[model samples]
Target: MKPVDEYFINQKEPYQSIMLYVRGLILNTLPEAEEKFSYKIPFYNCHNKPMVYLNILKGKDYVDVCFVQGILLEKKFPILRNDNKRKQVRSIQLKNLEDLDHENFIALLHEASHVLSHSKKAWFI
Candidate 1:
């Protein structure tokens, strides 16, 4: 299996389920995304730009679905976290299935992909 595949397959119960679901949501929304392992986590690049990434947080309680150009989409969705000292990445933390907001998640994914594809700046860098 690919390293990224192994990463997800090795996760425990609810974390596994959450990661799988988020993976589906992202791929379904952006079919062109290329999935790979970067920083030992699952990273997706869509339209030749950094798109999204998924991973289980260190404590093992949640999975973080991170958007590369999160700062642009933050105002649109309140669920996105901008806590990191770096301002470029934003993410949604999922602790359980209940935390999955399908509508908002899909919308955010689409917007993130759009920004990655259209933005002239090197947002990924």
Candidate 2:
């Protein structure tokens, strides 16, 4: 199995389901996104640039869907949180699939892609 698949399969209940659901939302929204395992987690790349990543931080109860240039996207998406004090990376934490705002999350994904397409500098660097 692909490492990305294994990463999802290895996760425990609730978290595993949450990650899978978020993963589907991401792929369905950005069909061109490339899914790869990086930093031991699932990372999505768009237009050949890192766009987002998913992970369940140690001791954290929720799955983190982190946008690479979230700082810029935050102007439009106040839902994105920087609770960890990350400068550019902002994320939404999902404890259950019910917590996901489908329309808003998909819109955020599209916005993040837009931000990536307009910027020339690599955001992930």
- Clash totals, every prediction: 0, 0
lDDT of 2 by residue, 3-116 (tens): 999999999999999999989988988999999999999999998888999988998999999999999989799989998999799999999988888999999999899889
* Candidate 1: clashing residue pairs, number: 0
Q: Between which residue pairs do clashes occur in model 2?
A: none
Model 1 scores a TM of 0.90
> lDDT per residue, candidate 1, 91-122, as tens digits?
88888989888998888888787877788753
Report the CA-based lDDT of candidate 1 relative to the real structure: 0.82
Off by over 4 Å in 2: none
- Poorest stretch of ten by lDDT in candidate 2: 116-125
Runs in model 1 lying further than 4 Å from the true structure: 121-125
